[model samples]
Target chain A: MKHLTTKDLMTAGIFSALYFLAIGLVTFICMFTLPVLGNFLLPAVAALTTGSIYFLLLKQVPKFGAITIFSLVMGTFLLLSGHFPLAIIANLGFSGLADWFTYRTTFQTKHKSLLGYILFSYGLTGPLLPLWFMKQQYIDNLTSRGKTATYISGMFQYVTPTFFILLMFFILIGAILGGIYGQKLVAKHFGQTSSKQISDLYD
Target chain B: MINIQIKCLLLFITHIFLFIPFHPVQQTVLVGLLLSILFLEKERKRSLLYGSIYLVLLGILIALPYFKSFLGHSFGQLAMVFLLLYPCFLAGSLLIRTSLLSDWILLLKKCRLPMYLILPITVMFRFIPHFKEDFKHTFRLQKMRVPHSSLFKRLERTLIVLLHAAIQSSQELTMAALAKGINQLETRPVSKLTSLTFLDYLVATSSLGLIVWRSFL
Candidate 1:
């Protein structure tokens, strides 16, 4: 396996920042505009928006550790921004899996990389894990904010098991749509240069 | 006064405090304390901005029950979250504004972190600002082209252009770093002073004290 050069690392940093910012902007907008629904919309919207950035990163640096490094940076950022530590663990786990799926693959067979992207998209769910596992903490937070008991209950009413499963399903669908869209956009816009680069790498 | 490590420690401590549930008043006090630290660092503008934002959000949160509407509740919930995250935000702002990238690099190197982690972090700090500029330029260029284009088409084109720009910029940055012999550098000399002073110890001790008191309460 070819090691990541300084150039590759630098590219990773650029795209990772782009990817992080894209997701954050989309989520922030969704949060203010849609409120509770934003939580549901987050996974799908992020997947759709950031898919192109992820696909571009893969095409640019089809190396072993790039995705993992991206995940590490994101996880550390989330951790620093006051998320539960478990979120970071989940994020790293999914991204490591993503890295494995695309390991040593050429861009010609990019579906594996698409699968990797889907797994990467699933990492968005990590930050929300505490809402289920640590409900009381959230409840206490809501209560301490002087939210009425009904408001607190109403907030969590959507967090049913069925909704959780549906969320996973939506994530999968979103990833599929986003991944395909990203591949198409990348092929249309960045295809020529990246293909030449990939050919050079493999040849 | 404080070193980069101490600043990072304060950030970590503050974020951890955010995770644990606390009274709204207590959280406000903690955020205020962190904001005062920002003021001590001479970040008056940002401190004032954050302080006002906190106050506004607090006002909305307190007035939420009176409105008794979905939108009000939504805003209330959002306000509560922002209020909760205020300290972390303040700490992050303090850290980013007060410290230099070279200082971070020096501290990371001093701790003997791996090269992989160090390089990307440095590049990330540098490129975030660069990407913002790139996005603005790309959006303007998109606006200048095909004024009659559909919104979706224009957005799609803009994202494509931005990706291409990101690639070009990353290539240029990598070349620049290579030209600077970044890989060969043993230690980068920080332009700014980073020595720990009495203030560092005082802040560190107080941060620890706050954490302990909060946790035990």
Candidate 2:
């Protein structure tokens, strides 16, 4: 296994910091400038930024530590901030999964394709944890107000379908954008470096 | 510096608290107080401008209804709306004030998360300002060309520029990462450096305490 240098750690740290800043900026914009739309797009923005940075960082550092560090910090912030605790955990878990799927395999072949990066990076949104938490809260609100079980069930029946469809739409959008970005990056700078080329450098 | 972790906690608690059935007058006052705090603490001039605009719009929304029904229960509903809006503004201000982006990555490292997850998010975070800057630059360029376009045309053009910028920047950003050798799995000894500070603990405790007190105490 290749060992990461101090440079790699610093790179990851910088990337992670940038990631948080982007989310904060968008969240603020959405909250103040576009409340209704902001509610929908904030998560989408978060996902897009996360995917982009992850791909970028992974291509540069190719180390688990950087990715790990980024996710842990983000997850902890989410947990402490009292945002959707379950969703934050899921986000962190998915980050690890996405990294493992893309990088671990690429290491063997020594060729990190844009497709693999997009697929893995974009897959992190599959949990849609935030939406799930929001839906659950809505349900809780309805049920606690003395609504009948039937009413709550009916509400979910109507809401869940729409929510799932939206989630799928956002996920696809994130994947396509992530792919485009990854491909452009590969073509632009690392055209000669394949997973195989990387192996040679390390070997 | 305001720790990102504490800011996040404050935002979280604020959102949850807003849902409670507070009286409309109290809610409006709370919203005012929150907005005032944000206006005072926010650093970015542009964000402050946008926030003030939003607050004004919200004020108009609340007042318009009141003017029509000067003494009816609409005042109460308006107050409720204000209450709901208050936290969102506070959240926005907090986002601008705290250095969440870098700190978040550090915090993630301590937790032993994987690279795949971190990479995408990091990229996305970088994209925001780039998007903003690009959008503004393009908008200015377009305005020079069509200085008198109708509002609709101007808005349409702005959207187009934003989309194009997002696509282009994402590509550039990804390539930059690749050039830096970001996509491989290397083992680095996880730093023993703790991301948490005393402020983080204080914020967490206070936020949780506030929520508990509000909900049941």
Best by TM-score: 1
lDDT of 2 by residue, A1-203 (tens): 13755345445545555556556656776678754445445655555544445565666666655565556556644544334345455555656665666566645432343444444444344224443546555444444435567644543442356765785577557656755654564445444455345434433
lDDT for each of the candidates? Answer: 0.76, 0.51
- Cα lDDT tens digits for candidate 1, A48-132: 7788899888888878989988877777666554454566788889889989888855554668888998998888888666657
- The stretch of ten residues in a row with the least summed lDDT in candidate 1 chain B is B183-192
**Model 1 alpha-carbon drift over 4 Å, by segment:** A28-36, A81-86, A104-108, A142-155, A192-203, B64-75, B110-112, B185-193
lDDT of 1 by residue, B125-193 (tens): 776777777767776787788877786686677777778777877777777888888854466444656
DockQ (model 2, Cα): 0.06
Quote the chain B TM-score of every prediction: 0.84, 0.61
- List DockQ, one per candidate, in order: 0.46, 0.06
Error of 2 at B143 (Å): 11
TM-score of every candidate relative to the true structure: 0.86, 0.50
lDDT of 2 by residue, B1-217 (tens): 4455455556655666545543334433444444444454555564466457656745654443334332232333333234344555456456544555556555445446566545544554555466567657766877898999885466446644443343344444445656766554235333434466665575567556555655562
Candidate 2 chain B: 10-residue stretch with minimal lDDT: B70-79
